[model samples]
Target: MEKLEEQIAHLTRTVEDLSDVVARQDQEIALLTRRVALLLEREASREAEGTGGVVLGDERPPHY
Candidate 1:
């Protein structure tokens, strides 16, 4: 009975540790997702501006 209790305690600790790891990963994923969204918005704004006015990718010279 004592051995069973020890096994249960170890399992409980392992589950708690895994839960913490998952929580941290979830937070990181949320942060990374927000960053990616911001980056995408910035890129889109740049592309829109480039299309509206100047092309920054060296497509041609101003004289041509």
Candidate 2:
């Protein structure tokens, strides 16, 4: 009976630790998902403006 109790306690602790790790991972995944969505939105806006390929700080092309 004592060994069984010890085993149960150990298992409980392990589960709690795993749960915390999973929770943190879930939060990180949510943050990354939001970042990806924002980047995609910005890219779409740039494409709509016809300047998707324009690098930053570059002068206007000769055609301009």
Candidate 3:
């Protein structure tokens, strides 16, 4: 029937749209995962080098 066909078409379009959204989200997640890994590596290296000290409140600057 025409009504059934119309419903099928609508559903198919909705599914395709959802698929696109999911693909985009997958790419974004992958990029963020890579960035997090890089940052972790950098932090680890900094720790190993014994640099990157944390300054507390009321502490004088190292340049002082």
Which candidate tops TM-score? 3
Give the C-alpha miss distance for residue 44 in model 3, angstroms.
Answer: 0.4
lDDT of 2 by residue, 1-64 (tens): 9999999999999999999999999999999999999999999999999878865576776577
Per-residue CA lDDT of candidate 1, range 1-64, in tens? 9999999999999999999999999999999999999998988998878853555795886788
> In model 2, how many backbone clashes occur?
0
TM, every model: 0.78, 0.80, 0.84
Off by over 4 Å in 2: 54-64
Q: CA RMSD for every model?
A: 3.8, 3.4, 1.9
Q: What are the lDDT figures for the candidates, one per model?
A: 0.91, 0.94, 0.96
Sort the candidates on lDDT, descending order.
Answer: 3, 2, 1
| Maximum-lDDT candidate | 3
Query: In model 3, what are the clashing residue pairs, if there are any?
Result: none
The backbone clash count of each candidate, in order, is: 0, 0, 0
User: In angstroms, how far off is 1's CA in candidate 2?
Assistant: 1.0
